[model samples]
Target: MVSNQNSKNLYQALWSSADILRSKMDANEYKNYLLGIVFYKYLSDRMLVFAVDLLEESASDLEEAQVIFTKAMDDGEVKDDLLYALKDEFSYLIEPSLTFTALVHDVYRGKFQLEDLAQGFRNIEQSNELFENLFEDVDLYSKKLGATPQKQNQTIANVMKELADLDLAHQGDILGDAYEYLISQFASESGKKAGEFYTPQPISELMTRIAIDGKEDQKGFSVYDPTMGSGSLLLNVRRFSNEKGFINYFGQELNTSTFNLARMNMILHGVDSANQHLRNGDTLDGDWPTEEPTNFDAVLMNPPYSAKWSGEKGFLDDPRFSMYGVLAPKSKADFAFLLHGYYHLKESGVMAIILPHGVLFRGNSEGKIREILLRNGAIDTVIGLPANIFFSTSIPTTVIILKKNRPNQDVLFIDASNGFTKGKNQNVLEPNHIEAIIDTYQKRVSIEKYAHLATFDEIKENDFNLNIPRYVDTFEEEEPIHLGELAQEIAATNDSLAQAEKELATLFGELVSTSPEIEKELAQFRQLLHGGGLE
Candidate 1:
């Protein structure tokens, strides 16, 4: 149970240490250095608790909390089972004597222990089977943290000491909250580069809703993201999801480094590796074990924009691409990613993917893919999101929801592009924007200008072009230029001009409505001519 006060303390402490490194490194680089340290701390704390539990359970000479509140321990068999469970639990094996705080306190006491700190991080990552290679090249003592070994180690040690002061309660409180706080802080500062990795919270919330709404009871089916970044998108689904069906989380990412971060994020968010199987490789090229693909209920993604791929000639034969009768263009692989997500979706599963607006209107092979998707009614909904919501990209993106089963042949088009606000450096959707989008999806409501339910005949007439303008009619005709009003206004202006000419002894120039100087002078002349010169 983390109180708001405790959360604040954790935020301030972690941010202070991270802030020290801001001037020393780029926003992206600082993330590795800082997240590496925080993760190191979490592992250290877990290990320390495990060590103490072992000491107490076995009556060994180590500090341990008295089992004050548990009557179930009265059974020796129960005690044995608990011990075995703790031993098997990688998340619970830490000892208090070896806590991160203990080590950092030593550093604050004049001990420059960089080697020890580095080894501690390595040991914890190695100790956990799934988290191996988790902090690759995140060497806190590297030249990236500082120039020389002495300076690097010294700064690294100081950073550890500062973080030790933070009150991040484990399992559910401080550490986990602080990790999210840091990820957001770093993401915002990193700009468009961050967008490539992190999906904004509002967007993720909406995606999760689109995936999990109405599926809360049935279990065994899973949800996946083919291009999992920080794992925030997957983990958050579990948090905000309102599911009537059970969904085990799954995903794959080409970036091994981000894959590791995704795994760590899932664990911190209370998802065991047993529940979420994250693969590290290009999902498009790799055949995710048949078991992984066949179990999903939903999939959500915000893949890299227009990523270049081996889109070789033979790729037309790949199962994910071959079915469409054409390959996605070599240069822009938006639909390629979409097809991959679509293939992984369960027969009745739903998947929502973020893509550039070009995917809607781009012709050639891309148009063919769109035709196949719509012809089969795989497209459930098309949502246009506000701009700057993504990190490395400020361009507005659209979310394409593909369902294996659509009861109706009508495609839902939502023009929510103008629904967000401009944040300090980026565009952001508030809760209202997220809710409106989610409600529209749930109710399938038709908003006059915001959403349209377009039939297949209409879409076919547009030649399979899913461009929003064709469906939503967002264009506003220039409020009919009033020629009659213009003539009458012109006559009034001419009369005023005559009066002004008599009063100011000068000819009046006709007002050019579009001109800046004429517009300003018109007011002055109108007043002077209509009611004589100014007092």
Candidate 2:
């Protein structure tokens, strides 16, 4: 029952102290020390609760024995069995002195080696296989943290001691928020490398809702993002709640570090690992989890735009590409990722992915893939998003929603590029813009200036190019040139020029723009030059 203010306060207490490490070391290096110890503290707190509950259960069972001949209650003799059970339960205890704070405190007092603390972390991780390799060896005491073991220990001590003093209760999403803050801060500082993985939260939220389509009660659901960097897409699905709902998430990432980050992110957000298959492998190689081919409910992906992949090695037999007849080029894997998403999609599931505009009308294998999908009525919706929504890549991307089972044989195309607000660095899709796109998806109805529903034959006639402008007719024809109207417009322009010149002359003569302060100074100058005489 933590209030939002309380959560904010807790975050401020911990994250505000991260500036201490900003000057001493790289933020990415300091992340391990900060997050690793916080995770340790969380583990210890939960374990304490577990042990206390287990002991209480044991004590209740033992007290039922016919040994009620010990301490006297107010009315009569009471059973002593409860006392003995409590003592036995204390044996399975983690000493309070060994808590995360205690270790940090000892480091400040110069009484402990960092190796002991590192071993303590390993032991805590070993305490539960449920969290095996939860952090991918954060190495809080490794040289990566500092210049040497002692220096690393000192840095860790300072960071932990600062964080340990914070009041982060194990109640809600405080940890997740803190972790997200760290990631965002890293994104701001690390530039391209960090930007490659993390999509801004607002953008991610919009993408997830568009893909989920107001379904709230749907469980056993599966969603995915092939380039699931830090799992912003997967986590945002949990934020989706409508009259109908979605249940689970699934994703695969090629970068081992980013893969670990996604898994850690899911865990911090309280998503059960069983419900998410965040495998660490290249998705292009079909290195995805191959157990169940088409059991997913919805698949959403923002695969790296135009990234090179192994797409030319007889990929026609890769199962994902075999039916498409040709693999995408080695340089542009956009169609390849889309085919993989389409391959794993259930018969009724929807696949919405962000791709560069080139993928819509690219000739060759991509065009072939487009023809195959559209011919099968897999193309359901095509949404054009504003440019620069994704980090690292500022190219405007499109969302192609493919449905295996379509109730209609038409495609919905929405042109939203001109519908976004301009920001300082990039264009942004506000909440209303996202809502408008989702509304178009649900309605499948065409609008006058925004969306269009093109028939399958129309797409075929257009050579199967799914570009937004192909279906959505946003062309504004210029008014027919009128000779009389042009002559009148030219006369008006000449009149305006004459009026502007006259206004400028009179305004300069009066000089009314200068105030009384300047007028007083001018009077002094006139007195000095004209000997105080009126003209």
Top candidate when judged by TM-score against the true structure: 1
Reference-based TM-score of each model: 0.83, 0.78
Best by lDDT: 1
What lDDT tens digits, residue by residue, belong to model 1 across residues 1-535?
2457767777777878887888888888788877877776766555444534554543221122223103224556555665466558764433323456656656767765676666666666666577778888586656776788778877777677677654333446455656766787788888767765578778887887788777755565487888888877776666644441234778888877678777777767666567878788887666674662454778888988888777787877877788888888878888888988888888878898999999998999999999988989999899998877777787888998988867766789999999988888878898898889989988886789899988999899999988887888787778788999999999999989777567553444344478888788887776676575422
lDDT (C-alpha) at residue 156 in model 1: 77
* Collision count for each candidate, in order: 24, 7
Can you tell me which runs of candidate 2 are displaced by over 4 Å? 1-3, 24-33, 49-98, 125-130, 141-144, 167-169, 241-246, 475-535
lDDT of all the models against the reference?
0.74, 0.68
lDDT (10s digit) by residue, model 2, range 1-535 = 1348767766665675576677766765565556666666655444444434533432222122111111111112222343344335322223344655456557678886776666666665565544556666476655555788777767767766666554333545777776776776676566556655687766676667766664656666677677788887777777775421335667788876677677767766766545766677888875475777445667878788898987766777777888877889999988888888888788867677888899889998888888888878888888888777655667788888888867666888888887788877557788788788778878878998799989988888898877777777788999899999999999999989777766655544454326888887765655553442222
CA-RMSD of model 2: 8.4
Q: Which ranges of candidate 1 are over 4 A from the true structure?
A: 1-3, 50-86, 91-98, 167-174, 242-247, 292-295, 477-535
